[model samples]
Target: MARTRCDRTPAWAQLQLAYDNSGKAFDLRQAFAQDAGRFEAFSQSAPYVFADLSKNRIDAATDKLLFDLARQSGLQEHRDAMFAGEKINHTEGREVWHVLLRTPPESSQDGSHRSVELAKVHETLNAMLAFAESVRSDSGITDVVNIGIGGSDLGPQMAVIALDAFATTGKRLHFVSNVDGHELAATLKTVKADSTLFLIASKTFTTIETMTNARSAKAWFEAQGGTDTARHFAALTTNVAAANAFGITTTFGFWDWVGGRYSLWSAIGLPLAIAIGAQGFREFLAGAHAMDEHFRTAPLEQNLPVRLGLLDLWYRNFHGFTSRSIAPYHSALRRLPAYLQQLEMESNGKRVDAEGAALPFGTSPVLWGEPGTNGQHAYFQMLHQGTDVVPLEFVAVKKPRHALASHHTLLLANVLAQAQALMVGKVDAGGHKHFPGNRPSTFLLLDDLTPASLGALIALQEHRVFVSGSLWGINSFDQWGVELGKVLAKDVEARLGSGDTTGLDGSTAGLLARLRA
Candidate 1:
């Protein structure tokens, strides 16, 4: 079936009418007053994650229209296309099967073309995990430094830090993504050459930033009288020849189907595997696979990912909300907002649709936030009283990993209070204290912050992004938008060296001179 852009759908007009007629006047307080079952009706439980979407400004009628819009846009067909391993990434002529990366090996042995791909995925996964196990047993290495940018850095780093409780206790994990020498310099200062392991994680092994850091790290190791480069360094790249040329024999490869942002389930998760050990890594993959199955098999209305994506559309296209705030209550999950920023924006932040036609509406929202209590201090003031109606998502764990009972109680209280404050504002006679309440927020609760729960949570977000991108008629897999800057930077860097500012705009020339000096 040909993909239909959302704006052209009949339900799009119906949704607009619904918004103009009654959806715009949705008051959360009044909705609860009118319907005592609002909480149960709006909330949903998925694999390892339960969501309370009740505080969002949506009634049953609005939800029906949103569901209608999804069907009218052929979302089901697009979703199926992805699962069947069709080339849904039209711009790249590749199938998006990051789902397969987390799928169980034996279960994926069905006699299909995708089975072959799955076998290859399992082969690389087994090799990578074996290497990880070796690293875990090695007492010589004290630190592991991952050198890569974007997906290569974010997914593994975030997962490693988030699952610190499950990590093998001896190794320290450091990530160096930026091209600035200071980042590598700071990391190098922390560990001796013999005690450090460097993992170079570029798919093609030629990403400029990653290669630069890798070269500098190798130089540092040699300068420090370290021998056996192959013993200390490994490569997670498909370009085996290049990695071999760079003295890296230990390499694991993934296919073009694996996009960087969605690659933690692949060999790009080497650091995560090494940190949490092989078994813990497998549990993480299983959690994600469970979510994938849920997304593939569950009905649209009952699907958490679908429900969240539809709500995103309702907020962005109709309610005119420009950004979404992600507040993870756990301190270990502090990097979640940054990880999601890349996942959502980089995937759907497009001006044009799959056919290269300009879109009539916004695609991705500005996804930003700090950790919970910190964000409460910094931006909660604006969230509760700001003019713009940005939706907030709060992720809370039911059980605390720490032993401090009072601290956990306070943390949970603050989380619940923030959600309540957004919906039910305090009314005071004093002018400054007069708070207008009716804001929307989503509460995502996990049983605990384990590998499985974290895996399911991340997969849920990925599928939700897929749903929105599908409805928007966008190819979320390709990231051509990030390339122009790299090309421009090369020119600017040469100009900085030569002091030739020709063909540069005034702002660029001025900035270039200032940066050079």
Candidate 2:
């Protein structure tokens, strides 16, 4: 289906007019005072997550216009194209079906056209879970080291820590992604080679950072008299030939449709599966699948992802907010902002549209943040009184897993108070103490940060990103920007040893000399 770019739509003109008329000076406090049902009108419940979007700089009129923008932009059809297994990621000529990774076999069978692909998905999922179970039951394996970068590293590492309470196995899961030998070396020092199971998790088995760490890990294992590479090391990769060459027999493979940032639900989730057990892993998938169904079938007016995505556009395009701060109130979700940075930035940080045409508007907002309370001390001051209005997102869990009632109460109170303080700023006669109220924020709450809720939350973010990217008419699945840096780094690495300055720019040559010095 031919998609309409957001700026070219009739609704876009109305939105521009709306923003110019009142959106530029839109006051959250005034909006609330004027509209009695604003909170209920904006708040939405979807799957395992409930969102309070009332505090955002939007009203009923702008929301309706945004819904029209979604319709005019062909977001519904574009989203359907992805779920239908079309090669929507035209750059790579692959279907963007990370959603399929979470789909149940019975539900997947409903899409008869994708039976073959669905079969492959379940086959790999079953095998991966079986392997995870084996590792979980293995008492000898005291440590599980996952060697991968990007999706392989961030997704699994974040999930493992977030689901630490659910980990049945006593095994410590270590993720080494950075090519910096310090991270891998430090992790290796803590675990003995004999009791450690290394999972190499690059799809091609040749990601430079992953392979570098894998090679070092292998050498350390062999040096420490650790034999049985087949038992000690497994490959979560499609390249069986490369795995065999590297002395790894156990391999789990996912499809080409699964891109790196979105590969968490694929075999890349083995570390998480081992940590939380097969049942928990399945629950995680089920939770995400529920969100997927909501995104697929729900009306635009009632859709959580649609509402959030349109709000993102309202902030970025009209409000001219260049950044969004993600403050997960839970300590376990400390890495969430970092993971989302990659998920959103890498997915939609393109300068061009899907057809390679340069975009006239901004795409992704710079997503950055730390866990809350910590952020309250550090950057919360800047957020409260800063010149630029960076929209803040606060993620809070209603229930705590721990029995510390007072601590949990304090945590919940802080989250609520912070959101309130952002909106209802205290008026001070002194200029330094004055806080301009009506700062926008979106509050996301989960009943508990279990595997199911975590899965739903992550999936909600994924689809929300897709909604924005779809309207912007960009290929959300591709990350061509990251390749140029990698390609340049290879040449720089080679130049460091050879002292070859040929074709090197002045800055590169100068930096090379300084580094060598």
Candidate 3:
């Protein structure tokens, strides 16, 4: 039972056969014109998500071969290994269990594997939620500022703004991630020192940018005659001793199994909890938990994450497509592209396997895009006529969160039109007007972008990452890549302060001189 890559599988040969014989290229126009059931056959509904993959260049035989590839690749074994709490992240000897962070206490059957971890997950979650509720109800707390970088800053900040309409609490939320003094200065100008609460978010309480920003924020607060330091600042770091030494009384800890990119379900989601309150936050977790169960138990052919990941492998390995575009139609979900950029690129952007052997194949693709209509104006032209074949992923909501009906209709129309246009291209008589007709795209429709739906959507992405990582045989959880730069930056920062560039790279020395000047 040696694990196999998709290319080594027998199904890969079948896929190649189908791909070769399926004409010069599988044309979506021809497929739709020939089969009346094209849309119905390609579209699928699972939980809160519905995907319309009809616009893609794939055919019936393509899907069959892809499913066979999934079976032959041992995708099920890799998936189950993760769910069983095996050390799938072999590079760090850690279990990849961000999924467990969202699993509800009641849903875990009495003797299930998840039930064993349920007690600790809920214990921290409950304490964190209680703290969030307390902050929400506090009339003295007019503003909450979160100091973090990467996953710590992105997920909570994005969700809080996305769910602003659902926020009953009137408190304003601010996130400071940059080392630049201007960001903190601008934020501090708007809030009274006595009325603001700052959440210092770093897993180790030692991330240079986070700690620097936290210290600057504290300095500003103290200089402004703020008396109560303990009440005003809390921490979301596992390093309780560091937080205590810094004079913070409250702290929340997450397990090592939770990677920074996948930490939103852990205490990193404290800002979301503060924004939406305890009940809404719990609904978010429950939604993710439901998707976790679905991912863990669903058959490969029927599984949404599995299907999507298999498609990813097909595109990357077989078709040689390099990047995939994510277009979320709703304006509220604008940050989703950025959030996923970190989640996918940071997780699976590895050149080595879990055993640290250099891989012969590609890992994660470069994920970059803005919200729809916006991207339609910006990059859709390149996608329509660009030399490279970039697969598009469109996320559309069935219902609008906003009250503006006209805007929603126009948005939906643009979304539908884009996918339609991608499949059915226009060819004019003139040479410049000849549009290519075989570009591919995937459409994901959500019932709505409620906390529950968003949770499910994000969880689906997490599992998709898992599938791709498993197939690549890489440790997706540990981010050793992010560390080297941090280490280098410290040396550079000291050189910048002291005008010393002894024994540095040519580029580093030159950059140092320019900065010093």
Give residue 10's error in model 3 in angstroms: 2.4
Query: lDDT order of candidates, best first?
Result: 2, 1, 3
Residue-level lDDT tens digits of model 2 in 1-517: 8899999999999999999999999999999999999999999899999999999999889999999999999999999998998999999999899998988886545546588787888989999999999988889999999999999999999999999989877889999999999999999889998999999999999899999999999999999999999999999999999999999999999889999989999999999999998999999999999999999999999999999999999999999999999999999999999999999999989899988899999999999999988999999998889898889999999988898759988988999999998898889898799899789999999998999999999999999999999999999998888899999999999999988889999999998988888
Q: After superposition, which runs of candidate 3 have C-alpha atoms over 4 Å from their true positions? A: 106-116
Instruction: State every prediction's TM-score relative to the real structure.
Output: 0.98, 0.98, 0.96
Quote the positional error of residue 259 for candidate 2 in Å. Answer: 0.6
Residue 36's lDDT within candidate 2 is: 95
Cα lDDT tens digits, model 3, 67-148, are: 8777777878888787778877777888888878886677545876667677888999999999999999899999999999
- What lDDT tens digits, residue by residue, belong to model 1 across residues 176-263? 9999999999999999999889999999999999999999999999999999999999999999999999999999999999999999
Question: How much RMSD separates candidate 2 from the native structure?
Answer: 1.2
Q: Give the clash total for candidate 3.
A: 0
